[model samples]
Target chain A: MLEALRKISDVVWELPVTHKAGMRVPARIYGTEKLLQEMDEAVFDQISNVATLPGLVKHAICMPDGHFGYGFPIGGVAAMDTEEGVISPGGIGFDINCGMRLLTTNLTAGEVEPYLKSLVDLLFGRVPAGVGSRGSLSLSRTEFRRVLEEGAHWCIENELGRPEDLARTEEHGRIAGADPSLVSEKAIDRGIHQVGTLGSGNHYLEIQAARPADVYDPELARAFGITLPNQVVIMFHCGSRGFGYQVASDYLKVFLKVMEASYGIKILDRELASAPFRSPEGQDYFAAMKCAMNMSFANRQVILHRIREVFADVLGRSAEDLEMHMVYDVAHNTAKLERHLVDGTPRELLVHRKGATRAFGPGAEDLPAAYRETGQPVIIGGSMETGSYLLAGVSSGDQAFFSTAHGSGRTMSRTKARRTWRGRELWREMEERGIYVRTASWAGLAEEAGAAYKDIDEVVEATEMAGISKRVVRFTPLGNIKG
Target chain B: MPYEFLEDVATADIAFEAWGSDLEEAFSAASEATLNVMVEEPGAVRPLETREIHLEAEAVDVLLLDLLQELVYYKDAEQLMLRVDDLEVTGGPPFRLDALARGEHLDPERHRPRVDVKAVTLHRFRVEKTDRGWRASVILDI
Candidate 1:
């Protein structure tokens, strides 16, 4: 892989446009030599394929946590000219708007340590998880459509979360232009009962604490609500569930049939199925995708409400007394219309981020007043055994289209991880280390062993060095509920 | 091989290929392999309730994908872990599949659920006829 890549800087590599004939732009990768070596060679192939797509501006890029994926590398970030460029469901991935949310509390680890086990059990019971786990609330067809259109705002309207949560979420927890008519009935059927549920494999809700020693930028950490060591927080990872999957699957078929036959477009991989962003088919897909994105926000919002209720029950205090306020929520997978400076002139581009986080710099008008001076809060999750990080978007991030690595990307396959460790044993080990864990499937836990993923510290270091995003605080897990 | 898991097809997802003497046998084995990924055993599912599935796609590989996704829909929407009871495939530029599946609503004690396959991705998806009869390969996003 190194033989085909040209080192552009200490932490950047480039794949020349000459590598592929139809390529419209070069491909750039951010990583250290060691981290680059750890990446699968297929990532280069996938990213290069992405570069060949129509109207791709600047370059096809990948973050330090880059890994092999179907059409686009998991950590890929690309921007396309709205008029000529295309939109691909594979680029956004199956789990539309799969993202992370962090909630800050006044409580500390010491104050909650004694009840950590019970907290874990309570949270595990409250948040529906595992395969086929239906959410506590069942939505009728009409109510479900409202969720698709309203996003987290639906949760707020239903009294699941405070209005403040909407302020801190990406796109204010709701993206406009969702058309329920564009979404298929099968997609709605799959999503109706799955709201507020955590789907299996790599999805989790964790209780974490930030130690003083783990603080990276003290002032920034404080601004983001991290006050002192062991400050308690709750974080969860999930997506649109089966609704998003069906939407992507349903559209890939449309793009595959229309791209070549109607638009005369050609692609190297079928998984990269796409349509011009301005075409009728593309607009229809974008509309349907917004519905899935909104549904996901609503799903996480409902889960947040559940967490608050569980805490109140276990701690014997009102949620207000606990001060369980949301810090921020960010999506890792999405395609959005944004205006960015290209060659010193602003251009409207559809930015696609797959396994990448949007890290808009400070003073961006879209940010709430509290974050306007501090920049968007980027929540990066790690494995259950490893610690996670809270980073703030930096002005320097415009170099990579304002995107950064989403998480510690997987390094090993599920089969390999399961073969190396037993889930039952790992659960016991985590418990011994003071991290309580409740899982629906033990074998599923083995598939997510920390060893299966790239080291978070190294990935974050490379991200910072590449001028994408800067760290604010580091958080270690206290207890977790894994699906 | 009747059916076997494939390593290295994807980084985090699972992939497998199923073979058969005919298309029906191959499709049945593929469906079984997918269910087996979620539960300890596919044989453990009794034929208590039966659900019918019909799929139409532009290509043969897509026919397989639609079929798998149908089964996944049942698992997520209805909480049913099904085993393919019967299957049939026929026709042209537009391919079609008719299948019957049997299973029961998941019971944690009995199913010992392993993982939920979120979707059948087009990554490395293929369907081909070999000297041994027929084969299909799929990579599932979990």
Candidate 2:
């Protein structure tokens, strides 16, 4: 598979259309030589399969963190002409709008270190987590529908979020065109109480410190709100939880029935099931997807509220006095309509980014005023045992339609990781390294060992060399609460 | 043991293969495998409740998928750690599965939690008959 790729650059490779049949475009992959070599071969199969989808422009893309996934390989990205292409649930993923949110606090690592354990424990107890855990808020069907329509705004109206936080969120935390009627009763029933939950399986909230030495770009770091050395910031990774999962599952069954029968679209993989964008099935899924998107925003906003309260309580200060302001929120699993220059012509393309971040460059429209000159912040969370990064999209990012890697991609499977690292030992090791940890399950803790994932620094470096997103600051873990 | 997790099939998720002499046994094996993915100790979930599942799919392979998905749905919607007590699979134009699943509401302390199984994926999903028995392969998104 590696030999079949054309070396386009030091950090880029292309799988030509001739590599496989039914491909409308070639496949563009971003990775360092080592990263490409380490990539699982299934990514080649999946990305090529993605290239075959109708109306795909430029090329199907695999980010540096690419790995084997069901339909579209995780870290896959593709831009399709809305009028001519198709919409796929696989491309957006089961966890609709699974995203990352970062917040800056006036407190420094030194100030928080002594109380890190209490903070993580309090958060672990407060935030719902693990298998089948419900949320902090209970809502009737009617109020949940409002959450679907209003998104984070509902949280703001309910006094869970600050008005200023909305602008910093992607799409202002509410995707337009959401029709609650398009959502199913099953999806609502599954996730109605999950609006504020941090679901298990790679979901977590962490306290980290952005040290002065790790600030790759001083100006960019300052602009993104990392003003103090060893600035203690909070970051969380989650999505719409079970509601989003059910939404994707429900639509997959619907698309499997109607994709070829109604729209005559035949996909190579059953997981690649899709429908024409204008078709009734496609329009309805898109509408419902937005609702899940809103549900996710509401979910994260509520979690953010909990984090603020916990920090304030542990620190004996009001959240406002601590200046726990949001830096940015970015969704990795999603499809958004954006105008991008294709072959020198501006066209609205529905860009599907699965496990890939939208790294729109500076001057990109819709960016908050503060970040307009700096570009949108991209939060790539590493494993709990490793440090994470803050990155800014660069102008050169448009080459891949402004998409970048999401995290340190998994290298070892869960069973293998569990076999190699004991959960109790891993926890002790992290403790020795000055990282406070709280988890719902020790078995899950073993599966997330740092060695189970590729090096985050290398992944971020590959994206930087590829000119998609640039490094701003690196934050080492001080505390972690894993689901 | 009727089922065993496949270590390398899924990197970010979990995959398993279950086997039995017939469709009913195979469905039960797959059900237990899916249950094991959610809880480290399946024996901890007492038979405090039961739910009846009826599903019809285009083929036997999809019926297996649907059965596995039903377990995940119960976990999410009802917080039930249901495992297959018994099931019957019927062959037809639309394959059918009828099962009685039994388990109790999740007790975090009693049932050691693992990752949540989001959905059953179509990637490499299959059901086949071998020389010895029926075999089903599933990859669960976590």
Candidate 3:
């Protein structure tokens, strides 16, 4: 597989269409030569498989953080013809709309450091975590349906967040065309008590600070509502919990039967089962997927509310005094319709981004008024021990269809990490480094050891050097709540 | 032996192979292995209650996937970390699975949890009747 790749540039490699038979388009991978050499052979196989899917436009692209996932590479971005393309659930992943949200606080790390342990404790107690963890809110069948249809608006209407927050969120915190009737009863039951909860394995709520040394572009940082050194912030990473999982599970079966058995479309991997975008099965999954997308938006919104309450309780300060405002929220795993110039012609394409973030450049019509000049905020989270990053979209990103790497992709497997490190020891080590940590299961924490992932700094650098994204600021972890 | 975990399969997920004298036992062992991934002790889960499951699929492999997915649904929705107390399978053009699951809600004090098994993946999923017995291999998205 490595021998088959042709070097296009310092940070790009091409797998020609002739590399594999039946490939509709070529596969292009973005990464440093060192990164490419270390990549698993399975990534080549997976990306090649994705290129074979019908109606793919231009090329099948993998971001710098790419890794071998079930059907598609984790950081893969593929655009298909809206009128004749296919929609595969595997292309979107099991955790629908799994993404990140950043909240900027007026308080400094010095002010919060005194109460960091207490704040983390309060957050851990307030926000449920781990498998089968239940939240404070319980919805009936009817109310749950509303949550599916309305998304974050339901949370705002219930007074969980301010109306202004909608402006800072991707898709205005709600994805329309969510058909609640299409969601399975089992999915509803799983989602009823899981909202506002953070599930295990990589989901986290971390408190961080930005020092002047970490700021790459001061003007852009200030424009993003990030101020001087020591400014504190909170980041929440989660998704639609069990609701989205069941939705994907249910639809995958339907697609397998319909696309394969009925439509007679053969796929190399069963996990890549899909239906045409205009087909009944595809449209139904799209509508149902919107419900999961909205559900995730609402889930993160509720967690934000809980964080605010904890800050107030721990600091004995009013919400107004704290001035904790949402910076931005972005979804990584989703398929959305967007217009991009394809060969100098504006065409509507269905873009599927799995384990990748939308990094639309400045002046993109979808951006908020404040960000119209600077571009969208791209949040890239790192390990608990390592640092995170804040970036902005660059016009050059349009070349890759306006998508970028999601995070410090894992280098080691969960099993290997668990075998190499003890979670209890890792927790103690973090505390010794002045980084507070709280978790439900120690083994779960072991699976996310910092050593398990590539250096976030390097991954972010590769993306910037590749002209896919630009660095705005860096965040050093102060404390965290791991699920 | 009914089942044994296969450790060196995939980096992001877990996989196990199960065997039985016939199809029913292999499916039952597969359920046990799935439960063992979540809890420290599979037998520690007392069969305090039982919930019945009835499913129909076109093939045996899809039937196994459906049965395992049903267990995951019950775990997340009802908080029941179930073990297959009884299972019956009838293979035909329309394969069928009727299962009786038994367990209690997950209690942090009693049950030591591991990685949460999100869903069963079709990524290298298989089921076959060997010369000696029926065998199945499945990979789970955790």
Estimate, for each residue in A1-483, the C-alpha lDDT of model 2 and write its tens digit: 788999999899999999998988999999998988888899999999999999898999999999988789999999999989999999999999999999999988999988898899999988988898898798999999999999999999999989999999999999999999998898998888788899998999999999889999999999999999899999999999989998999999899999888888888999999988878999999999999999999999999999999998998999999999999999999998999998788999999999999999999998999999999899999999889999999999999999999999998899888889888889998999999888888989999999999889999999999999999999999998888
**Native contacts conserved, per model:** 0.72, 0.76, 0.44
Candidate 1 segments whose C-alpha is farther than 4 A from its true place: none
Q: A358-390 in candidate 1: lDDT tens per residue?
A: 998998788899999998899999988998999
Better by DockQ, candidate 3 or 1? 1
If the candidates were sorted by their DockQ against the true structure, best first, what order would they fall in?
Answer: 2, 1, 3
lDDT tens digits, residue span B17-105, model 3: 99899999999999998887776667778888789989998899989999998888887888888988578888686988898999988
**Candidate 1: clashing pairs of residues:** none
Model 3 residue A65 CA deviation (Å) reads: 1.3
lDDT of each: 0.90, 0.92, 0.88
lDDT string, candidate 3, A1-483, tens digits: 667899888888899999888788999998987777656677788888899998899999998888767789888899999887899898898999999999998999899999999999999999898877889997888998998999999999999998988999999999878999888888898888998998887889999999889999999999998996889999978988999999999999899889977676778898888999989899999999999999999999999999999999999997668989898999999999999999889999999999899999999999999899998999998888898999999998988899999888777777678788998999999999989999887878888899888788888888999899999999999998988
Q: Tens digit of lDDT per residue, candidate 2, span B31-141? A: 899999899889888998989999998899988888888888889889999889668877786887888999999888888988888999998999999898899999999
Report the Cα lDDT for candidate 3: 0.88
By lDDT, the candidates rank as 2, 1, 3
